[model samples]
Target chain A: MRSLAILDSTLREGEQFIKTFFTLEQRVMIVRLLDRLGVTFIEVPSPVSSPETREAIEAICALNLRSHVVAHVRCVEADVQAALDTGVYGLNLFFGTSNELRSYSHGRKIEQIAHDAVPLIRRIREAGRYVRFSAEDAFRSDLVDLLTVFDAVVDAGVERIGLPDTVGIATPRQVDRLVSLIANRYPNVGIEFHGHNDTGCAIANTISAFEAGADCLDVTVMGIGERNGIASLSGIISQLYIHYPDLLAAYDLTQLVELDQYVADCLNINIPYNMPITAPSAFTHRAGVHTKAVLRNPHAYEILNPTDFGVVRHVDVGSRFTGRYAVGHRAVSLGLQLTSEEIAQLTQALKERAERGSLNDEEVNTFILAWYEEKGSLVWER
Target chain B: MRSLAILDSTLREGEQFIKTFFTLEQRVMIVRLLDRLGVTFIEVPSPVSSPETREAIEAICALNLRSHVVAHVRCVEADVQAALDTGVYGLNLFFGTSNELRSYSHGRKIEQIAHDAVPLIRRIREAGRYVRFSAEDAFRSDLVDLLTVFDAVVDAGVERIGLPDTVGIATPRQVDRLVSLIANRYPNVGIEFHGHNDTGCAIANTISAFEAGADCLDVTVMGIGERNGIASLSGIISQLYIHYPDLLAAYDLTQLVELDQYVADCLNINIPYNMPITAPSAFTHRAGVHTKAVLRNPHAYEILNPTDFGVVRHVDVGSRFTGRYAVGHRAVSLGLQLTSEEIAQLTQALKERAERGSLNDEEVNTFILAWYEEKGSLVWER
Candidate 1:
């Protein structure tokens, strides 16, 4: 089993969501909830970005939550000083190292970037705060440049060296190879992985990173961040809970759905129906074969228990895709002694009705009751 | 590069969505669009499930589109006959193989399952149609059971053998190992992979399976199947586009968003904001630093170009996360000659207002114009 820690950037990364705007109160609420939920770290936006940002960071730091409050800042003196003023327990200093970002973002050469980042790393370490120096587009940067820059910060006493797939371009294989390369090179330093979801591989890439020996992963609530956002907190948790349940023993697993709900409600966005554990359909069994097997034994078709997440499994027996077995099960559960033939007939009728459109729960019940009392004789009965 | 084929099960699996009930016309429309989108195969529910299902399958087969029509059936002679009657070009036969599913689902031993499946595979092959025998819950099944059943069917002339992570329990490494085991065992038989999204590792697992020599992958549009559906059509495309753009050359990539919208609309669900390529936020850059760099060069922060999916990149400059560079860029685009210092001040003010709540485009313009006129701005004075 791989050791892992969670760092939630719902405040810092989520603030970059197009619809997200965290008030000072909202920031405190989010941080408090995340801390209570057992997130290892809660990252807030750089204090240098705005006065409100600085104040929010300061207030969150003052709350003295069990979770470490991390200030995500740029690799510059002013940003470093601002973060220092926030009294954050940790600092995440980043600079774009990819050629595209180098030319258009800070316009700094590799040597200059390393030279500039080292002092901030030293300053943050001197202040007795855990510090991480990140290459913002590590996946796209020249490998040699990433090694040189990461080495400089590590030598400057940074505890963690960060690799971010800022563009969400890294595949699982690529993430594995890159993290393996870096992890092998810096055996003593902690590795942090920050990935975006541009290619829908953020969660997988994060898992790959951990498998390759990264210690911490950066994620955001509901995956809300710039562009398609970063790895989602719930997504990462769901993956771990399914494949490596022991690693998630420290987390309050039941709070995952509510956490997603809270963030989605705050953002005024609907959770996608396919979102790992929180989506409505995540545990809904509707297909005939699946419904049949799941009814008998949920483990037949479910990898995770919805009850574990404070969610219920819904079996849509009213859908046209439902089978005789499911209909039979539902009828028996409703105290009806329908035979297999009757169940098949009723299932056929319900399926035809479903072909036109969906039937409500009441409608399904009405159909079942009506069929039970109706005068029509089946071919077998005749 | 790996050889791959797409098997879309939107009609079959999507019908299992609690809210999804596609009419014959709707099914036909979906099949046509998928065919046009270069899907290699379209799998529909077995004809044994409902009359409408059979008719839909027949209609799709009659269209003679580029995509082959497949009937997803149970491992029973009756289901095989029903599927054969539908005129589908291919048949996907599945039965539970795991101890959990064996004891609870069909109450069949490995011998009974293999005995029942071999005849069906032979029968389907005799019909001169493509046949695939899948071991449901393959990941959880005892390896010997899977090998015995798969080998029996292969000997019985099944054209393809399927490995389904029925509960989405397999990790990428597990998937790779399993697929490699099967691929190595049956050197002549084609391998198919069907994965569920219960753990959000379906797409990555699919990629891993392909990397391990699986030839065909099962996907559904919007991933709307039972229990959070299967691997999403667009998600897989996004992964391939990111890591193997050459493989997606045959696909009508630009139609991905429309495909997602069509499915989501039909299901009456909002596309989750974090959906890979089609969600509204997929291309919306909100972080000030990201917006600044994205404006200069989109590749600086994006791995996949929005235009490739007929989508546009939106740089949100009014959000609190917006940086000085973004404010200056926006102001310059608006023909305002603000100095860097003034831009910084205005950005800070805007971020504060944003912290209170979001600012509309008009409000943002008003703030900028008012600040320009009322302040003793250095640029204006000059």
Candidate 2:
């Protein structure tokens, strides 16, 4: 089977998230954590951005962590030298190729971009470090322009070709086709995908790249990066766990919780409630149909096993539409005994009361206890 | 061009979210708002689920809104009658076909499922209402079994066929292939896609199905539903605005901010920062490279136009990574005159001070004003 390698960019792309500003210590801590998380690589911003940035990269490289440390740098000589000086395992060199970025961000023709990138790639390779040459805003770049750069960089001994959907505008179908085209052209070179989530397709686009033979995928914690960010490590891994479990054999998937928590704490934002696998409701079953089926067998509703991710499934039976099975389960869990008839009646009562809104466990238990009180001197237990 | 329709499932699937419990009036208001937003259909829970659910459906129907109202119901006759009784414009009937659900949720043979569904679908059609037959957990269902049931339902005159990625296991490629297969088999039937975000592919899968000839796409306000929810309305629309503007021409896209805010308020959760379109950070540019380019041309980095969604782009220059151009722009806006040299020096000082954390505008300005004080009695123009 082909490999699906992760290059976590929490320190590089993630630092670009508006709310994030990683300290030197925080950057080191993140690199160490990512190393333990078994990411194939840990990407950091180029050292030239600031003194602390340079120091952080140097400290990270000195850690001798398992994950390779790569610095994302512009296709400029000074930037390349600064990154090389930091002793990163490699450098991710990029030049914007999209007409908009070319006109506004960097005034460079597509032809000239590859020429500039080639010497840098060759120098980095001669320095005994890996290098990836990315045509930034690649999805919008002319296909021929992209291929021309890839050819030049590959010939210059670049180890990987990075295709970034800088604007996050590429559809999964579009990304799949493009990655497949590039993968076919450069069968030996690692193809890395860095997709933004502006369209909420980062995870899908990353998976499409993988399925289409792209070997390396870039991700951040909570998909944190510029604008809507890129694919989250947890989101990507969760989908992989569902369809390609073998790909994650080296991963201690449970540690994702700590990683996610650390990043969320750093940003001072709660993990999005709708985040896959790591969100508050990723494993919570509340709808009657879901709650009933899940109670019968969790597989009936859950694709990702919560326990495997160091999270637990919560079957909330206090909702208006929750079925009698969930209500009975709730009653039993609350140390209340009731006949099937009583459970049905209690379920009806709770459903009606929940019309205004759902009840909490305490409210549900109180109602169940009240119903049970009429039946007998029910002994309440914790 | 083929028509792409929307079926907003906020009332039906969104209410199933653990934190959501729409009161009768709130449900009515949401329905009215969605209708004004120009969604083609509004899906509500089966009227038989709760008294308020039924009342809300009746109230919505009586409003004479342009959007079609549909109720999601089980394949049972009583559920169909309950939906029909609510005067809904259509009924969405579903039965589990996945092995896990077949064995645990509902112990029905594949043969029996269609046999039971066809008669109910026929009855709903005879009632002169639109009828949709959804194969629940379509992704995991045996293809032959799903096709067999689809054949029976289509033969029974079903207006639409829903392929729900129940438990959110389907990849975009898989959904595309499956939706294409079904769409080709029944060319006249409207194909609906209802994908869950358990693995963060919901938005991509929904768009994939649409691209693959699925006519109807289901979306919630924030993709809120059971578990991690489904595709968000704003997320789907943002991607469409970027790549398939024609598909969304019939809708008022700017109103998405209100829709997202309403749902977030109802759920008592913040709009996720990574959410596209309506998210607070969606248009906030902070990275120096991004801020510089965006100030030069917003399109350089942004795919979705913020103003199109009634949101403004914010170029924050207070952070360490912000470029000198942003600082200069801030200086200009703050009515401070600084030469290029002065701006660069101030930029350096600010970058050094911001290593501990990003400074607010106030803090950045304090340093800016202090630098100005040293230069001269520079009449700071606001």
What is the C-alpha lDDT profile of model 2 across A248-311, one tens digit per residue?
9998887888888888998889988778888888899887888888998999999888898889
- Give DockQ per model, in order: 0.70, 0.77
RMSD of each: 2.6, 2.7
Residues B196-305, candidate 1: write the lDDT tens digits. Answer: 87777788899889889899999998777776777888878888886777888898987778778887888777777767888888888887777788888887777778
Misplaced by over 4 Å in model 2 are A377-382, B377-382
| TM-score of candidate 2 to 2 decimals | 0.96
**Model 1, residue A117: displacement in angstroms?**
1.4
Clashes of each: 1, 1
Per residue, candidate 1 scores C-alpha lDDT tens digits across A1-382 of 6667799999988878878877778778888788877998899888877777788788998899999998888887888888888778988889999899999888999999989988878888888999988998998899999988988888899888899988888878899999999999999889999988777778888989999989999999878888778888878888888768898888788878877888888887777776788887788888777778888888888878888888998888787776788888878877899877788788988888887777766788888888886735443476
Which predicted model would earn the best lDDT? 2
Clashing pairs in 1: B288-B323
* lDDT accuracy of residue B69 in candidate 1: 90
